[model samples]
Target: MHLDNNTNSEGQKREYCSNGASRGGAKIIKTFSSRNTTQNLGNNRFNNTSNIGAYENNPLIKSGRVSLDKTYNSRTNSKFNNMIPTTYETRDISIVFEEDRQNAKHYDMLEETDDDIIVTGTNCDTPICFKTWEDMELDPRLMENIKKSGYIKPRRIQAFSFPLITAGYDIKGQAETGSGKTAAFLLPIIDKMLKLKFVSMRRTPYALVITPTRELALQIHEQAKKFCLNTPYECAKLYGQLEKSSLNRELDGGCDILIGTPGKLKDFTKNLQINFSKLAFVVIDEADRLLEFNFANDVNEIINSPLCTPISKRQNLLFFATITKELERYSMDWMRKEVATIKNKRENEVNNKIHHNIINVQGLSKNKLVVDLLIDEQKQAEESDLSLRKTLVFVERKKVCNILALMLMNYGIKSASLNGDRLQKDREKAINEFRSGQITVLVATDVAARGIDIFDLDHVIVVDLPKDDFMTYVHRVGRTGRLKKGTATTFYNPETDYDFKDNLIEMLQNLGQDVPDFLQQ
Candidate 1:
């Protein structure tokens, strides 16, 4: 990396360096000594902040410091520097990047890589290596598909999980939502299918992907389909929302990659003659949620049913937003004997994309507080053209979903409600509308917190915190900050949930968020 020595107005020698390779050039404008850094997608450095420029509106640069010379890209000739600007009104995208991941002080305090705590029991025949997707020598078609989907680089989980799964090892991956876990599993599975030239016939499945919610199943289906294009494979989605006849028709059609909920799969196996006898690979997405009482029995029954291939024969991949050591132990009882556990570091696992926060409040003012916050967000969106896409307000009780939806509308905020109690069609419609940007706010329960993937969601506010541990809190706020960095602000009312206080403080501390002493007790 090259360093730029320049003097600020105060005549202090300030050192600014880009993380990218240093390009030797023009004589030093000025010399400074101090450590301050800036990084970006394109290898662009800006140390000449003296002259005034026209494109001063770039939010990443200080308004006064922005100048025509600094804003122009020397290579691409793009107007807004070399980096592609996101459609949303955003500030420095790399500002929150954790330098600790390097040998720097950041990772020393709270590292983003779980290399320290990893447990590898799988006796793989081949050594796991490579740090990026390019190094892996994946299938040409799959690589082309990945680039078409605009993924320039693989995230940490994807980098680590892909090699293991491709080598045919059972793995449990723990990463926050939006960290690209879907591709981490799907890419390897698809590549293996292509390599083996495997094909599934009607009434039989080669691959089974079970998720906690239909929404997540559909999300995975959409991405998996993109990867299956132009290949000798097809993608089918099975959820409770389909009618009996329609579901039967899909089951009759060939399913190279079958994505569905556990309960629906069990129903099909019991009544629709759906077969999984030849299942080669099984992905239990959101494994922790599958263990919840609402789904645990059905999930257990499906995996152990005679229709499913034996655990010893088929490869297994379990993924969750959060999985503790105790929970991992619980999952281990069912996983294969030599399952590989893949976990991103705790600091990185808490959804770093979202700005996490907790605001203490009395129970009664909770509604008003949420309304005021939404109003403020709306006003800011209008002023900055950030385009508030969707705000999800999560509560513990199902009834509160409806109550908050109506109350938000009464307060002049357009809103929707999503919960398990709603009809399957209604549930699908709610998800579709919210995703299409037709709806601004959605009030939901914990049921929608896990497994549901909503892109471009602007914010997630927990009106009432869950009594569960830190994992639930992470999933609740993880609804946003995807598509772009969003906010996860929660309201903490001690009177309503005194038990949540300690976990809240501990989570904030671990996630690198501030914890006020008032909430620490």
Candidate 2:
């Protein structure tokens, strides 16, 4: 019999046969008193220290039953049969070793790699990236809710952000839209809220989320409700056009988490006797959009409200699809100077699964082109035995959005329009119809570009590209390709869009898409 060296669960070095042998049998054959320079298993054996580790750590081998060769069983070798327990079966040993090798390799990778996410800030103290929800040590009820929500594991952003936020450090995080940034901040904050006892005397909220748009505020509130299920926490949303009485009713009924837009939140602080002493968390979502000239003053006033918690006292979190130096500079005025920034290293890298195409509409009409594209998409879906394609057509102005919806309807295409000018109820109806597949196409302005999560979106058609901001173009196309493969087609007019051509060409090249000849000129 040929012998090979291996260690058991205990630190005892012993030699065993390559064919098969139990730990007790190995102990009897060769108990090493000192280190050996080399060892042999059989004529077919090879020397490799890696295999030794695999064999020593393999569960099957450690359980006192190493697989035996079928040839050994054929030979009525009484001595060999006696050494190996009959409980062990004759099976292919390579499969067992491969599994052990793969497991060890994966463990090593997990230990050695942190390149997937990039984090940086002033005096940044790095935070742990949890691989599982259990690693976060979340409340049992919260964990149950998370599982019920079908979140098996936290996304990369969530993995890194959870620990930082849970540790009560102000963080500025940037990730691509629809990358689960909401849940990253929400889960950790909810976990913390569950730990603190609710004070009966407290009148203000425990946490406040300020978003750029009303639709986004509603979406966040909806998601928060799911996580807060079966818990004592209550969520309320405030935005423009929400009846004052209803807003008061939500507040009077006791809201633990209040989510709202700047204008309405600013009004609430001025009109209502809301207390901010109990507020422990503050989150600014879509920080780039909220910092725009139109919303910036209101955002500043709301944050600086006398009743609001001092910047030093509360944990602050700012999330953005695209983080900029200007936005970061503005944030530092209100946020902690030492705020740690967690960013997805791959944020600028567009998904290769999304196909991007740009057409110069110098002479052709964009309206007819969009209609043709939608019709073609419908035909393709039917040919492929797939569901009807759901698409979002983006325009630059509310007028164009309304006009395009009407034009589509005139062309016998069932469509809806979502823009800021639309009534709140009307906007919600359009979103619901489009989301439910009752309407295949929804035309909107930049208002739908951020913080809106729609599943299974098949395509995005940018009928009117943003005037100057390339990131706005990114956000527009971001409407689709969320959880599935999608396509984005932009209608560019060189006459008016010449100034923005270079930006578009650069973005297309970065995404590995071909830039058109016209744009090259």
- Model 2 spans with C-alpha error above 4 angstroms: 1-115, 122-126, 200-203, 346-353, 383-386
Question: Ten consecutive residues with minimal summed lDDT in candidate 1?
Answer: 84-93
Best by lDDT: 2
Summarize candidate 2's per-residue lDDT along 315-418 as a digit string, tens digits: 88898877778786778876876687888677654544456666655644456556655655555556768655678999887655654564454334567777
What's the lDDT for residue 49 in model 1?
Answer: 36
List TM-score per model, in order.
Answer: 0.72, 0.75
Model 2 scores worst on lDDT over the 10 consecutive residues at: 81-90
How much does candidate 1 score in TM-score?
0.72
Per-residue lDDT of 205-316 in model 1, one digit per residue for the tens? Answer: 7788988888778777877877876787877889986787887787666688899988788887787477778888888888877766467678768777876788888898
lDDT (C-alpha, whole model) for all candidates: 0.63, 0.67
Top-TM-score structure, candidate number: 2
